[model samples]
Target: MSGRAAGGGERLSYFEGYRAIGAVVVVIFHAYQHNRDPVTWHWPLEGTTWHDLLRATDLVVDLFFVQSAFLLGRPYLRACLDGERRQHARAFLVRRAARVLPLYYTAILLVWAISNPILPGDWPDLLLHVTFTQTFSQAKIFYTNGPAWSLAVEMQFYLLLAVLGALAQRICGRLRHRSARLAVLLLGIAVLAGACDGYRLLAVSAWRLPDTYWPAWFGLPAKLDVFAAGLLLALLAAGGVRLPGAAARRLVGAAGIAVLVGGSVVRLRPGFPETFVHGVYGAGCALVHGASVLGGSHGPRWARVRWLVALGGMSYSLYLWHEPVLRLLDSHGLLPERGTAAGFGFTAVLLLAVSLPVAWLSYHAVERTGQFVARAFDGEGRRREYYRPLPDLPAPPQIRDVTEVLSLRGRLPAGTWPTRD
Candidate 1:
């Protein structure tokens, strides 16, 4: 199956590359937290250097948004015009939700069992995470699972794609030429939103702005431009779009890289609509444009491995799972101290040893299985039932119930696994 449906018709495969790299960067950024000892883990880089990397890692999230829009938009656009497109929307939505919810919910459940005081105690926090809307409002975003916030943004983007698809259908009425124009117009909305926001911030005074400012408002829409850019590329690919010339393509690519870097540095202020303006939107748009025109493995040779690509496929799971595990290790004395060289070195080795296996196994076992089941059943309820606590939430009983499973290579005898519920 050509990695796409048979004769799938000029499927945009560019997203697969960046999507993988973005996931890796997020994990490495989080792992940096565990390797902070100046004595042991210390080498050539300073802590500030690592911090800069972490802060910049947020740009990777925007890449995910662009991919989401491009991949999700295609089916959505098709559904708007053709019966086949409509027929596949349910399956498509299921595949996306399945890819996200299982691992997210798994992490949430694991965290629930731990019951750390750092997490919010209120029911609202749980509701927010469960509904995939935590990132929408500022109340308490990035709770138990810090990275899930982006998934919330993606969920919101899903809603946006639906609206765009409907609007696309209404404006063009199934005419390919009209559809292309309307798509370009939507793409402009993405670009204009960015330009207008930048203009407002440069032009307006803070005191004159609205009283209730929301971060998600400006933040979420900033990503929309990136997604829209990718969607536009999809239309271009369908219509055999090309850069004006080779030189023009390279210059655009260079400009895109610059915008991506700059967007990462800009200060994101409140009081503007998310779509209309934000640094990330510009960065995301730049990334989408560059990827659309120049994509074909521009990175080093290491990025081309099947394992790297596979890890990229499960990158979301790895990203969501890695951080909490590192944090828990640190909190539980499993990780080393933050400032010491010896402590840092110890933590680095410990984290690599601990995280790799957990990540690989989780990807194969719970994540892969749950995702398959999710896409398989494609129904309303029972199949989607992902959460089920061990009765009474007791530690020993939970451990005992798991003692009978077949062993896979030399795992510590069943009795040694942590049993705390």
Candidate 2:
């Protein structure tokens, strides 16, 4: 909570721990998908609780979206509410590009080079992915790497946030009071979220588009509600809302966990409507994240464990590479047999063992480098360049000599040398 986490000097909080847990769970979910038999492993209604939880892990992707929105939105919202200088859109986009594009492009190339023979796609698919427009194409959405679709969504969110933030800053400038500005911004976000939710319902229920439809279901429009949850959380935090005490914070956290579990369970029920499933899950994630921020302390002790924090720092790379690593292991016959409890445990453990080191390397090589580049290019970096201290000049020797000579001749008073122009 106090000290910075690994990647940069960004503040560390319970969110990093959440990132670590989410990344690991996603890896396990994919592992289960690969190893389970579709014939025997039915939906949760007929399956075990473990199976339901495994299935529910897919929802963890929304947690990443919420986290991103909260982290990025908080500063902008604070600036608006407090009447501070607004963030530059160009600088924000540049930083986002530096943080996201490098690793994403790397993953695309790596996956293409290694998996082309097995998971083939054409040049247009590659082009779409390169432009972060793959999510618009049903065929290309999961082409290079399945998890990369989320990265595409994240890129879209970044662009949208930059634009919206700039517009919000301008609008807030016209408002008379902080509360008025905050209310107007919050209402705008709420309206946007409501519109997205309506679109999702129409797509799923009325139009009868499958939830797997790329543009309607997996795209930014469908997912903005989740991001709005984070944006709202940021607004509340910016407005100075806080939990009164540890007990209240704990209670909120417990309620969040309950909502999350309850949502997951309901999601697994036979014939549950898909229209609101993701929204419910997003609400739960928001609640949990809200409690973490509103709490007075750093968080629970477990959330601050050094290794967990480190894992969280490397989580982006881990999320990107874990699936490919798992597939590689499977191809080489390194993984255990499928459909057994022992096998699942072994596969999960082996994936973690192999993937952690790879993720650590990627984090250092790609992510950290990206952060450095972002800092070197953004507004702060430009300002630093402009204000950099001038190197100490060799003490204007000619002037000093002239003063000494003038003083010796008594043409200038002692300690009253002429000032340098």
Candidate 3:
């Protein structure tokens, strides 16, 4: 697609709002992202209470995962369906690498700079971050920064996108029917994902071993479904396919609320039979998409909570800096215990206390600077150098998506494609 052709369109405003929510939810989840229980003969469901603050919040990560898949997959999936599938495959990989790696490695290096040099396998862990394949490894993602683990997972999804995306184009080219192509992609995804999940749980009992003990890189098989789910959602959106409009949105929104509330219900009653996970959780994905899509495309109407949006703007930075700050407090005993209301309050307030300013400057200094530098390098040849665009981003100031900017990078200006100035 030409620059002009790609630049004009209505993007999803509800999703931008939803992105803010997803990022914040994930950040909250990451603030206290995990639950601990000793090995037992009984199912690990005990003590995993819905009212339990830390455990309850872990659900937020699910929101983050779904959002990541939707946003990243949109345009590429569009290009594939447009018979220009090959166009995005290269730039998508490059742009994705650039967007993620700089901030990612900087965080990793910052951790390395402060920690013991001689710690066991520290060098290898650092190597993992640099290669952007750290998710496949078993290392605790950041020694000081716990949230980076999810970032690693997100990157892994991108890598999966790069590979599967190329194959998808090849397969899509042979099939003339859009419906057939979509069907094949969906079915491949379903079979592969279900197998992977099964393998991850039943076969890979090696969770107890160090990450290196497992031969695979990044639980690729296990997590493939999550990424596939996102990819399909993107395909749906990019094709101009609309799910249930107002009515569907309301229905799905109600369902999502029910599932979320069901967690609370499961918590309040004994022997309530935790039905959320094993029964129809994937349906919730479609429901959330319906709610967001059906809400329609419109800007924020309320003047109130604008700062929340601004803070949401810096959510990525907060993700980067919040955990370390929390760790700093927790190490010093500034934090309250985990189960108490006081513990949740302490974690939340302490995160916002330092994160607001830090996240703001990070957007300007780190994210924006990194973006500018990445863009400047995107133009090909000797005129521009170093980390040129990966071929997905829309050109700077052209009102294109992020991928188009990368695609414009290192190219001979933007007016024409398959042409050199």
Q: Indicate which candidate wins on lDDT.
A: 2
Per-residue lDDT over 299-351 for candidate 3, one digit per residue giving the tens place of the 0 to 100 score: 23431145654555556776677666666666788766554444565566676
**Per-prediction TM-score to the true structure, in the order listed:** 0.67, 0.87, 0.70
Clashing pairs for predicted structure model 2, backbone only: none
TM-score of 1: 0.67
lDDT of 2 at 252: 83
Q: What is the C-alpha lDDT profile of model 1 across 214-286, one tens digit per residue?
A: 4434345435555666565555544444666656666666777777655544534443333333445445554
Which regions of candidate 2 fall more than 4 Å away from where they truly are?
Answer: 1-11, 38-46, 117-121, 380-421
> For residue 243, what is the lDDT in candidate 1?
66
Name the best candidate (by TM-score). Answer: 2
Every candidate's lDDT: 0.56, 0.78, 0.55
Evaluate residue 94 in candidate 2 and report its C-alpha lDDT on the 0 to 100 scale. Answer: 80
Candidate 3 backbone clash number = 23
The alpha-carbon lDDT assigned to residue 246 of candidate 1 equals 54
Clash tally, candidates in order: 9, 0, 23
In candidate 1, stretches whose alpha carbon ends up further than 4 angstroms from where it belongs are 1-17, 32-54, 77-91, 116-121, 136-139, 174-176, 179-188, 191-219, 244-250, 264-302, 340-349, 374-421
lDDT of 2 at 416: 44
Question: Model 3: residues >4 Å from true position, as ranges?
Answer: 1-11, 22-50, 84-86, 117-121, 133-142, 204-220, 260-283, 294-296, 299-306, 331-340, 377-421
TM-score, candidate 3, is: 0.70
